[model samples]
Target: MTDFYTVRVHHRQKGTDYTLKVPDNRYILQTAENQGADLPFACRNGACTSCAVRILSGEVHQPEAMGLSPDLRQQGYALLCVSYARSDLEVETQDEDEVYELQFGRYFGKGKVRFGLPLDED
Candidate 1:
């Protein structure tokens, strides 16, 4: 039998909460979208943090969450696009840029660009 879990998502930007019945065999984001949750996502390949969330409760199995660093994962960050429910779960959607900065800020933090302004060469 496929294990099903209740996954609650707190969408911070929209100030909405979505409750979903997720199965251990499926990724959370896909199920969520199918259920009309209208969540944010980009590059649904687990290589980006556009669908990042912070686990508020319960467990998840996300062996393919390559977008998250181990430290971030240890701190309860998860990429819903590649995560499967392991138990009843609660998560809060994260700002993609914040997660990206946390994940790769060290390597790409040096460049800043202003809109409509030409970047300095050299």
Candidate 2:
């Protein structure tokens, strides 16, 4: 088993590729359809190539990278969402969309938004 830290991926598709322990936390592309503290993206199947990015360093495991071309694959590119941490790896994701941090509220509704632009009224 391996421990995974909540890492902060730099830009949408720009970052480092340092080795990480196996069984590390999965990757969630900033462009993934489902966005958390991570980035946001479209089709996660790897067919769209919207989440493709260069790997500055580190390694990754992609069980199902459908459209990753040989040239692109040879260039150290990867789909952030479908890939998993194999052994402590680093990657680049500068083109990814930004996902603002969320405010977790207790069951009793104690938490609230911390910061960002204000909302508009209807």
Clashes of 1: 0
In terms of lDDT, which candidate is strongest? 1
Q: Report the C-alpha displacement of residue 100, candidate 2, in angstroms.
A: 27
- lDDT string for model 1 (1-122, tens) is 99899999999999999999998999999999999998988999888789999999999889998767777888999999999999999999997588887755654545543341223334
Error of 1 at 105 (Å): 1.5
- Give me the overall lDDT of model 2: 0.49
